[model samples]
Target: MKKTLFFASLMMAAQLNFAQEWKPVGSHILTPWGEKVTAQKPHPEYPRPQLVRTNNWQNLNGLWKYAITPVNTKEIPQQWDGSILVPYAIESALSGVGKEVGKDKALWYTNTVTLDKSVNKNNVLLHFGAVDWQCDVYVNNQLVGRHEGGFDPFTMDVTSYLKKGAKQEIALRVWDPTDDGPQPRGKQVNRPNGIWYTPVTGIWQTVWLESVPKTYIVKTKQTPKLDEGVLAFQATVAGSQAGDEIKVRALNGTQVIKEQVGQPNADFELSVPNLEAWSPSNPKLYDLEIQLLRKGKVIDQARSYFAMRKISMEKDENGIQRMLLNNKFTFQYGPLDQGWWPDGLHTAPTDEALKFDVIKTKEMGFNMIRKHIKVEPARWYRYCDSIGMLVWQDMPSGDLGGNHWDMQPGKISGGNRDKARSQESEGYYRKEWKTIMDVLHNYPSIVIWVPFNEAWGQFKTKEITEWTMANDPSRLVNSASGGNFMETGHILDIHNYPDAAMPDPKIFGANQVLALGEFGGLGLPIDGHSWQQKDNWGYQSFKNKTELLERYKQLIRDLTRLIPMGLSAAVYTQTTDVEVETNGLMTYDRKVVKMPEAELNTAHQALYQAPTK
Candidate 1:
């Protein structure tokens, strides 16, 4: 009887252990970092790199109990299904809960944190790196606030939500209609096939808590004027008195460059002497220290960095319009980077994984990346700025109903046949586009703003393009990337699939630069790395790596031929395979290298050589 009882105990213990072990739930392709994920710590890095605060902050990105219920339900669930990974979208494999939450269903998350009394004495601020669609945040069951938008970051002051103890309970309720709603969701839908992908609901980025002084510098905007050798900046203050002043300091690796005094919420310029211009080949960044002062005493301080660079257009010796970086013509060649991960979707699994694509693109001899129809986390752009990779940012497309298109080089008309949009839709586009631009404007890598892509939600072509150009005059504007021919923007762009092509200079030679926005989607699907086994496809499919490489090399050779014809820049089809689209330079899982990097780099090098005068 005793032996029997002991065996029963062992069996019970084993069962509980098995139940608690964390494992990814989906069978889709997974990245290397995804394979190594656990419930302990995920993406444990400072989420905001540009605004660095090293002390009095905590990471809340481990496992959290989650539930999916009908959207009509409001009460918190008495019991959770299981632990889902925080910061990974619920539909993602890395979330450990590959469950779909539809438009009729609402997703929920709950976690607990132990507040440090030493730090909690200061004002506590709750930060959600990003949440999909719409969400309501609660601390200790009290409603703190609400937010809308799937891409940008939002924060709330939750100090009042704290109780007398060290522990505090936080909850999140999220609902995302995905493609069902007319929002800025990029290629995500209820049905997953072709270019559209699985819906991402709930928290998809780092969630954390920080303590700050009552009077803190909430945000800082920096614009560098290299020609004038000065950095113009402005700071937004949260809680401040009338006489509060601001102190700014610039440093180049411990050597002080400049220091100045300015008032909060006032425009000020700091002289940067002996400044080195930032470019693709030579990226230099200067560290910045900003402090908020009250009566000559420091109240709040933050750290940041900046780069001195300029983007413009110039007429070359051949009397052709050319895109110039720092007053020099450097042909921008890169991939149409659709920022997606097999494991995390919009959010990358790790910081290192996030930077991997940019590093590989640079290695493959690409100077620029057209961030396609989607916005990435701020860190992605920061990495590009640090590594000196140029960026052309595209506003994510929505309500995309318009005429079909063909790459008509040198077309005189912008084909101004834009989509007829309702007033609500037009206002939504304008507001969101402006907000996105304001958020990402500080990054020096983004040289161009692509307002529309392939006529997707292309409306008010002249007005939108002109507004974009006027608002950010520092960078050249590609108003429509491979869309309806527009006469308003700086570049005349076109898209052609699976082959090298370019806009003709014959028609618009004097006014606009000619560019091939997209081309060369050479696809090779390895058996184990694909999202789906049987139905995967690319714009142009190849049987093996050898054939893919040869075809890719030939395309590169053909692209070089267009340079003398006033082709200013070009973008390849994509950086990596996402879901059913198997036309990536790298595999979805990122394990297989379809083409030899050295050979591809060699081919890409010839495109950037000096074109004949």
Candidate 2:
């Protein structure tokens, strides 16, 4: 009876602790597109859309055990500090463990999970959406793998370490040197003040597991050509035997476009008769089904989709470079999406929150968004494709070798050209940059590849531009935007402050496309919607929506004159207000829209229509 009573007491305590875990916040805010993000089912869709798998897959999201420890420690602490929501950064309030982890310390995460019998029969791959800096993974007390790099996804095959039908312990150890080390830590500082806000540590992305056969498909490539009316399909296999046949299928809605048999690693072109081209308007995607077959029997299968579209830069009327979508010039204008949320740092609080940003940006009548310095979940890009928005993906900036103040556009101590040559730094940057590009190269909405932004760790600009051209001849390369315009690439970009400024098309030669890479940081601080209380700032401060709207309109009106002079694209400061940075169309909480929707929509529509001849 004493033992039974002790067990009952322990169960009561467990239930009490479960009740106090991190609960969803900000469920009441109606998104900019009138869609409400509620607590019941926030971000319910599959996070990774690029790679689809269907076998022993389980989402290890919801809640996890977490602790903070010294960098030198290798053992788990006796007690967890508390529960935190996975996929959200530690510095975020929604993560429950709102704390800072410096270079001197490490964050540890532990979780116990029971593996399905099916996963043990084959290979089990453990995947992380992203981790801040460095992470070591262990399954069932055995170290499986380790990964470095915060923003990219990494996986480890954990088949050998599993004990079927028994609970397994998975542990992760992470260390991030935000601004303290020479890594690609973008806009993260130990003491986040001004533009640099909050340092993320540990796993700030979804953790999950999937089961695959002995010989399975690893990666698939989809390249669409609208003019040819064909989609090129290629599959990279892991352990395929000789005489293996792979079947590829393309479906539009419920109708099948084409299906054919092909060998692994070989490109197979599938034709679509009545293909509807993908664009900012009428973005249509055809569903793709892939299967691996042995002796005419299907062994494994996966699903993916692709859109038929092509992006290029060509000389338009009067010999000025313009972005050509489907062989025609379409001016791309949208906000500089920083991809930050009030509750979640790297990960959006909910899938609806992720979709809302794209939807709202579209409602503002913008055709494109320059995703600045951060790669988001694949679903974010999928939503952009669905809702008809173009994307210019920027690799997250890091290794600036100094503080945020040191990396500003016009603040270089010397104009000495020799200082730009850093062979060691350049090598490391190229390695990481290639990894980032290879990972996100499949997404269709991503048009422009920006190698460097404002000369942050920018060395050998001309060579890097040449390499980017050789690597990806399909897309346009903006070697460096805003600062240190080398006048080498297809686009001549400039970044201005509160006021919009356009680069001289004549100075860069008549062939270069003039673009305003960044502008319009109009700040309006809501009473409670702020990361900090004092010293909050923006490019241009305003007390009310009325003043903010008037100034924003006038700025766009000034930009209209530059369009005739060869301005083809313009990206505003940001989509949402980040911590301590109040220059956003919406407040940090995403509860308020700072500008009148109609007025901003009218200004953005000017870009969509061709400039007056």
Q: Give each model a TM-score.
A: 0.94, 0.91
Per-residue lDDT of 1-613 in model 2, one digit per residue for the tens?
9999999999888756764665644432223322333322235466668668755577777567889888998876668887767777777656666788898998988888766555554678898888988899988878887788878888899888887665888988888988877667777888878888678787777787888888888888787877788877789888899999899888889888789889988898888888888888888888888999999888888888899898887776667677788887787889999887766777787777788889989888888999998888878888987889989888777767432222233222234231253565565567767777777777788888887787676666678777887777667887677756665677777788877777665555365777889988888777777766657889989999888888988888887777777788899987888988889998877888888677789887776664734
Query: What would you estimate as the lDDT of candidate 1?
Result: 0.85
* Candidate 1 pairs with clashing backbones: 414-485, 414-486
What does candidate 1's lDDT look like per residue over 465-509, in tens digits? Answer: 999988888888998888888678999888888778776676676
RMSD of every candidate to native, in Å, equals 4.1, 3.9
Query: Which candidate leads the pack in TM-score?
Result: 1
Q: In model 1, which regions exceed 4 Å deviation?
A: 1-21, 402-407, 412-416
lDDT of each: 0.85, 0.77
- Clash pairs, model 2 backbone: 43-351
State candidate 1's TM-score: 0.94
